[model samples]
Target: MVWFLQAAAAPALMALAAGAAISALAIRLCAAPVETAASAAAVLVGTDEHELDADDPGNLGGPHLRSARMVRHGAALSADLVALSTAGAAVGLLLGVPVLAAEGIITVLLALGVAMLAAAAAAVVPHRGRPGLERAALQLGGIIPAVLGGAAAVAAAALWIPSRYKDLRFEDVGLENFTDPAITGGTPTPRTELEPMIEQALTDMGQWVSQTDESQYASAFLDVLTLYSVTPNVVVAIALGLGVLSALALAQLLGGAGHRFGGSVLRAARTSRTGGALGITAGLGSTALLAAGGIALLVLVTAVLNVLAAGVPSLALALLAHAGLGALIVAAACAGPLLAPVLADRPEAAVGLRNAAAAAATGPRGVMLLSGLLTALAALGPVVSALQLAPRAATIWEDRSLHALTPSALPLLGGIALGVLTVLLVTSAVLDGARRLGANAVVETRASLLEGRGRAELGELAEMVRRAAAPALVVAVLAPIVAGFGLGPAALPGLMIGVALTAAGLGLWMIGAASTLENAAAVIGSGRYGGRGSWGHSGALGGAVLTGTLRAAIGAVALPLLLTTSLVSALAVSAVVGLSTDGTSHFLRWGVAALAIIVALTCWVIAATAPEVDLEDGEAELSTPLFARADDAPADTLAAMDWEVGDEDVERTPARARGKRRRGAADDDGRAPEDAKD
Candidate 1:
C-alpha cells in the first residue's frame, strides 16, 4: 500500500503543479494581445497631455477611462480564472476529499503541497508572448524547475508527516484497502483468498465445455442469456438515450472551445505572420491525438488484462494492471479533450497536430488539474460497478460453478452514464478555457471561418454519429444477431423489435441533439450576444444551456415512449408467429429482413441530410480613411473648389459658369459685382 501510494502520489502532485503553472501562464499570455490593444485605445482616448501609467490603477482617472483601461488590461482574463478556479476547486474538493478521506493527513498534505508549488511556479514563470503553442512551451520550460522543487518538497513532507503522525496507517493506502464491499456490493476478498474459488469455477467450465456438442452450441448460448437475464429492451433504450444526450452536450462544449482557440491562433498568426504559428497549431493537434492514442492503448491493455484474468488467472497481476489502466484512462481523458478544441480549429491537419501537442505539453496547468479531478469523479461509477460485480461473480461460481459469468447490465449502464458525464464536463472546461484565451483575439480578426457557425452544424452531426454509433450498433446489430443464432426462431422477433427501436430512437435523438448544439454555437459565436462577458454573451450562453438542457429533458421523456413502441412491435410480431403455425419460421425470417431494411434506410437518410460546413474565404473586409465616417453633408460642400474663379463670381453668374470666370473682382471690402455691375 505504501509503495502504491508513493508511486501514485509523486506523479499526481507533479502533474498538478505543472498543469497549474501552465494554465496560469497561458491565461496571461493569451490576454497580452488584448491588453496591448486596449492600452493603445486608452492612449488615443486620453484627454490629458500627461502619459497615463499602464501599471497604476489610481492614475487611470475617470470611470469610463478606468473601464477602458481595465478592458485593455485583460480584466476578463481575471474574471474567467476566478470563475473556472472557483468552480473547479469546488468540484475537486467534493470528489477528492471523500475519495481520499481514508488516507487522512497524507492526502491533505499532498494537496496543499501541490497547490503551493503550482502557485510558486505560476508566479515565477514569464507569460509574455504570442498566445499559441510555442509561447505555451516557453512558459512550460520556465516552470519545470519550480515543479521539480515542489515535488521534492511534497516528497519530503510525505516522508516526515507519517513519522510525526505515527498513528496514521500509511500502509493501509494500498489496493487491498481501497476496495469497498459496501460500494462494490461484493464480499471483499484478497486475491490469495479468492484464488481457490477461481480455480474451482475454471474446472467446472472446462467440464461443461467438453460435454457440449456442436449442434447444442446455440442452446448453450441461449442458456447463458437466460441465466443472466440480459435482454435488450426499455433498459437499453434508456441507457442509449442517456449516453447520446451526454455526448451531445460534450460535443457542443468542445465545438465552442475549438472555435475560440482557432480564432486566437488565427489572430496571433495575423499579428506575427510567422511560421511558428503553424507549427504551434500542429503541435496542439498532435498532443490531442496522442491523448486519444493513449486511450486506445489503455483499451487494448484492459482487454489483454481481462484475457489474462480469465485464462492465466493471475489475481495479483490483474489487480495491478487494473490500477494502472485506471490511471492511464484518467490521464488520457484529461489531456485529450483539453487540447482537442485547440487543434480541431486549425484548417491544416499537420498544424492542428503540432499545436495540440504543444498546448498539451505547455498549456494551462489549472485545466489539467481540473480535468484530472473530473476524470477521477467520472471513474467513480466504473470502479463502484466493478466492485459490485465481484460478489455477483463469486455467487455465480459458488452456485452455477461457472468460470465465465455473464454480468448484470446495471453496472455497464451506470458506467456508460458516468463516462458520458465525464466527457461532457471535460469538454465544457476545455471550451471555457479556450474562450477565455481567445476572447481578445476576436476583436481584430475578420469573419473568417464563418465564426464556426456553419462548421459547428456539420461538426455536431458528425460528433453525434461518432459518439452514438458504437453503443447503438452493439444493441441493435449485435444483440439481434446473437439472439437469432442462440435463442432460435421464436426469440428472433423480440430481438428484431429491439434493434428497430434502438436504431430509430438513436437516429431521432442524434438529429435533435446535433441541431440544438449547432444552434447554440451559432448563437454564441454571432457576436450579437456581446462576445465574451457582455450581456449578449450571457444571453447566448443562457440560450445554449437551455437548449442542451431541453434536449436532454426531451430525450429522457421520450425514452418511455420508445420502450412502449418496441414492446408493442415485439408483441405484434410474436402474435403473427403463433398464428402462422404452418410457416411460422418463414414468416419470422421475412419479418426480420423487413426490419433490417427499415433500420438501414433510416440511418442512410440521417447521414445524407447531415448539415454541411463551408469554410470562409481568408480575405479580410477592407477598411480605409476614405470611408471612415458617413458623408452626410451636401455634395457641393465636398466638391473640389476652382481656385481660378474670383470669390464674387463663385456666388454670382450661374454657379456652373463661375468655374470658367477669371479673377476679375473689385476691392476686397467692396461688393463682388462692382466690376460686373457695368
Candidate 2:
C-alpha cells in the first residue's frame, strides 16, 4: 500500500496542479461575463459611479455578500463541469476507435488533443473569485475517480480479450496455407496474389455461415446474448453502484475533515467554541450510523430478493415477491427523508415520516414511476456500454486475428468513457436528491411551526408530483414496449424482475444516503449538543456510530438469507416449467400482485396514522390569522375618523379631534401617559 501510494503521488500532484490552474482560469472567465453584465446594468441604471467595490468595507454587505455570489457561481461551474467531463470522456473513447484503424504518432497526438480539450472546456465555465474557483476544484476532484476507474476497467478488459479469442485459428479458413507457399518456396508474394487469397478466404467464410445449421446459430446467438448482455449488465450495475457508495463515503469523510478544520479555525479566531465540539461529535456519529444503516439495508434487501427469486419455484411466490419489494421501496423512500429531521434531535421527525408516507400513499403511481425512470436513466449508460462490449470485442478479435498483432483498445476505452459518464450521472443524481430532500424537510418544518400541524404541505406535494409526472409517464408507457421489442417474451420476465429490483433498491439507497448526510449536517449546524468537550455531543456521536454498526450487522445476516431464498425459489420454478411463456406470465402476475399489495399496505398505514399537530407550546399562537394584512395597524388601535367641518365649528373641531387622538393613543398603548410617568 505504501508503494502504491508513493507511485500514485506523482500523477496526483500533476492532477492537482492542473486542476488549480483550470479552476483559476475558469473563475476568471466565468466572472468576466457576469461582471460585464453587472457593469452594463449599473450604467443603464445610472449608478455606475456609485457602485460599491466588492472589497470596500463601506459596501455594507460584508463577506457574506461575496460568499453568496461565490455559491451561485460555484453551482453553475459544477453543472458545466458535469457536461464538460462527459463530453471529454466521450471524445477520448471515440478517438481511440481510430487508433485501431491506424496506429501512428498522429493517434497519440489526437489523444493529447482530447485531454487538452477536456481541460480547456473545464476552464471555460464561469466562476467568481478564488473561493468559487476552489469550489470548482473540489468538484473537479470527483471526476478523477471516474476517469481513473474507467482507465483501469479498460486495461482489465484489454488483458481479458486474448483469452476470449484464443480458440480461433486462421489456418482453418485456408488463408494461412495459401500465404505460406510463396514464403516456403523462397519467392516474394505479389500484392495481387495476396488480395485474391484474402477475397477467397472471405467468400469461403460466408459460404460456411450460410451452410451452418439454424439450431446451432440460434444457440450461439443465445450464448452471446447471455454472456454479453445479461451477465455483464448485471455485473456492471452492481460494480458501479458499489463504486457510487464508496465515492459518497469518501466525500463524507472529506466533508467531516473540512468541518473539523473550519471549527478549529473558528476557535483560533476567538469565535465561541461552546457547543461546537459536541455538535461535531454528534454529527460525525449520526453520519456514520446513517451511512452504515443505508448500506446494510441495501445489501439485505438485495440479498433477500435474490434468494427468494433463486430459491422459490412456486409461481404464486414469484408473483407475490414484487408486492413485498414494492412495499419496502415505499417505506424506505418515505422514511429516508425523515431521517434528516431525526438526526436533528427532533422527535417530530417521526411525524414528518408519517406525513411523507401519507403524501406517497396519496400519489403512489407518480412516486414509483418517477423513481423507476430515474433509476433507468442512471443505469442506462453502464448497461449499454456493457452490452456493446461483446460485439465490439468479437469484431476486434476477428479483424485483429486476420491482420493485426494486438487486440484493439477501443472496447476498453469505450468502457472507460461510459464508466466516467455513469459516475457523473450518479453523482449528479445524488446531489439533486440531497437538495430536494433538504428543501422538503425545511418546508415541512416551517409548515409544522406555522400551522401547528405536521401534515405534508400542498406546495411541496404539488412540486413532487410535477417533477415526477412526465418522467413517470414516459417510463410507464414506454418501458414495456421497448422490452417487448428488445428482449423478447422468453427473457422479458427476468429483465422485468431485474429492473424492478434495481430501480427500487437503487432509488431507496440514493435517497437514504443523501438524506443521512443532509440530516447529520443539519444536526451539527444546529448547535444543540453544547461545545466540543460536552458529554451530550460525545454521546450523540457515539450513538450515531453505534447505530451504523448495528445496521451493518443486521444487513450482513439478512442479505445472505434473502439471497439463499431467492436462488432456491428460482431453481424450483425452473425445474417445474423452465423459462417458458407460462413461467414468464406467472412472474408478471406475481409482480402485479406485489404492486397491489404494496399500494394497499401503504394506504392502510397512512390511514391508520394521522399527522398529530402540536397545538400547544406557542405554535397555535404563531399561526397566521386568516384575515391578516401586511399594512394593517396594531389590532388594539382604533381607525382614524374623517370629518367635514364648517367655518364656525373649525376651531372647536381641531381641539376636539386632537383630544380624541390623545385619548385613543393612550387606549392603544394600554396606559395613561401621566400614570406611566409616575
Candidate 3:
C-alpha cells in the first residue's frame, strides 16, 4: 500500500519540479523584453514629440500627423509584451506540472493554441515595412517546436508513470524457471528456494519447469527488439537516417543537374521535343553516377553480411538466406526504374513513381527481414540449444550458455542496422537518379501522351503503372525471406503485414501523385485564389496520400500483431491460471499480454508513417518561389505575363540560341559554365 502511494506520488513531485523550473525560465526571459518595450513606450508617450501632435499631417505639410501609425505601433508593441509574458507563464506552468496526469494532453494542446495566438498578436508590432511580418513568421516557426516538445514531454511523462508500476512491484520472470516442475512442487525444493507444491502442480499438469536462465541481459534485449514489433526504435532511427540521406541525395543530384544543364532545360522541355530529349539525356547521364553508387552499396552490404555470417557456425545458413533475400531486393530496386515510366500518366508523376519505386526496391526490406529473423532465432536458439544439450552436458544450463544462442542474433541485428544505413544511402541515390531521369522522361512523354489522346496514352499509363507497382510488389514477395529466418514458425504472417503495408502505401502514393498532377495545370490557370486552392489541393493530396500510406502500413502490421499476440497471450495466461500455476505462470498469463499489445500497436504506427513522407511537396515548390505562386495567376494574366517575359527574352536572346555556336566554348579554366563564368 505504501509502495503504491509512493509510486503514485512520484509523478506529482516530478511535475512540480518541472513546472517550477519552466516558470522561472519564462519569467526571466520575459523580463528584458517587457522592460525594454515598456521603457520605449513611456519615453514616446512623455516626450515633446508626443505633445507636437504628429496627428496633424499639416504639421509636416499635411493634416494629421501619422498618429494612426503611431497608435497602431504602440498597441502592437504593447500586445507583444503582454503576449510574451503570458506565453512564458503558460510554458513555465506546463513544464512545472506533471504533464502525464490525465489533464496533461489537453493542457499542452490548449497552451499550444494560446501561444500561437499570442505570437500572431505580437506580429502586429509597428514596423515601416513587410519585414516585420517575416520576423513574426520566423518567431512563430521557432516557438511551435518548443511547444510541441513540451507537449511530448508531458505525454512521455504520462507513458512513463504508469509503466513504473511494473518496475516497482514486479520481480524478474524467467522462462527456464517457469518450465521446471520440481522447483514448483508443493514441498520445498532442495536445489532452489522455489515452493515445492507449485512445482508438483506444474509437473502433474505436464509443464516443464526450471529455475535458471535469469540474466538481466536477455530482458533488456527483449525490451529493445520485441517490445515494438513494427517501427521499433531501431526502425525509427533507421527511417530518420534514411529520410535525411534522401534529402541530401536529392539536393546534390538536382544541384549538379542545374549546374550542368543550364536553366533553358526547363523551358526547352516545355516547348520543344529536341530540347526535352537533350535535357532528358543530360539528366539520365548525370543521375547514372548516383544509381551506380546505390548498386555498389547493395553489393557491399551483401558481401559484408556473407563475410560475417561465414564467421559463425550455424549462422552461415542464416547469412546465406539474408544474401539471397538481399539479391531479390537489389534486383527489384534496380528493376523498378525501368517500370516507372510505363505506369505514369504525367511526366512528373512518373518521376515520383520511379523515385518511390527505387526507394522501395532498394530499402531495408532484406536487412529488416534478416535482422528480425535473426533476433527471433537468437532468442529461441538458446532455449532450443540448451534443451537439446540438456541430457549431454554436465548440467543442462551449465553448458547451455545464452552466449551460444546470441552469436547468430546479435550480429544479425547489428548487421541489419548497418545494412539498413547502406541501403538508405544507395536507395537515396537511386531515387535521386530516378527522379532526374523520370522528370526529363516525363516532360518528353507528357506531350506524346496528351497528343495521342486515349489509346497510346492509356497504354503508356498502364505501363507506367506496372512499372510503379513492380518494386513494391517485389518487396512484398521478398518478405517471406524474413519469415523463414524468424523465430515463431508463424512469424511470416507478421512479416507479411509489414510488407503489405509498405507496398500498399507506395501504390497509393503513386496513384495519388498521378491523379493530382494531372489536374495541376487546369487548377493553377484559374486565378490567384484558384492557384492557392490548387496548390493547397496538391499539397493536401500529397499529405493525405502519404499519411494514408503510412497509416495503412502501420495499421496493417500493428492491428494484426496486437490482436494475435494479445489473444494468444491471454489464452496462455487463462490456461495457466485455470491450472492454478506458479508465479512464473501468473506473470506470463497477465503481464506479458498487455505489454505485447501495447508494443504491437506502437510498432505499427511508427513503422508505417516515418519513411515515406511528402518530401517533394515540402521541398520543390518552396525552392522555386515562382512555381509556388504560379497557381495564383489567372490564365489570361499568366498569358499576358508570359508575353511580357517573352518580349524580354527575344530582346536578350543569346547568340547560341540563334545557332551561332562557338567551337570549343569551354573556358580555359576548365570549370563548368556557371563556375567558369564565376
Q: Pick the TM-score winner.
A: 1
Q: What is the lDDT of residue 336 in candidate 2?
A: 23
> lDDT tens string, model 3, 1-678?
112332233234323322332332222222222222222222122111122121232122111112222322244323322332222223222221221122222222333343354334334422111332422332233223323333333333334333321122112111112222322333333323333443444343322113324343333222222211221122212221222233223223222222212232222222222332332333334334433443343344435533543232223222222222212222122222212223332235433232232212112222222222221221222223222222222333322221223435442233233323322322232232223223323232233333443211112322332233233222222222222222221232233323323322332232222222212212222222133233333332233222222222221122121112212221222222222222233334334434544443443344233222122544543433312332454356654563344666656878776333122333454555556435
Candidates 1 and 2, the one with greater TM-score? 1
Query: Could you arrange the candidates by lDDT from highest to lowest?
Result: 1, 2, 3
TM-score of each: 0.28, 0.26, 0.25
Q: How should the candidates be ordered by TM-score, best one leading?
A: 1, 2, 3
Measured on C-alpha atoms, candidate 1 has an lDDT of 0.31
> For residue 148, what is the lDDT in candidate 2?
40
Which parts of model 3 are misplaced by more than 4 Å?
1-152, 155-459, 480-483, 486-678
lDDT of 2: 0.30
Q: Which ten residues in a row have the lowest lDDT in candidate 2?
A: 96-105
What is the C-alpha lDDT profile of model 2 across 459-567, one tens digit per residue?
4432332232222222222232223222222222333334434333343333222223223332333353353333433333333222222222121112111121122
How does each model score on lDDT? 0.31, 0.30, 0.28
RMSD (Cα, Å) for all candidates, in order, is 21.2, 23.4, 23.5
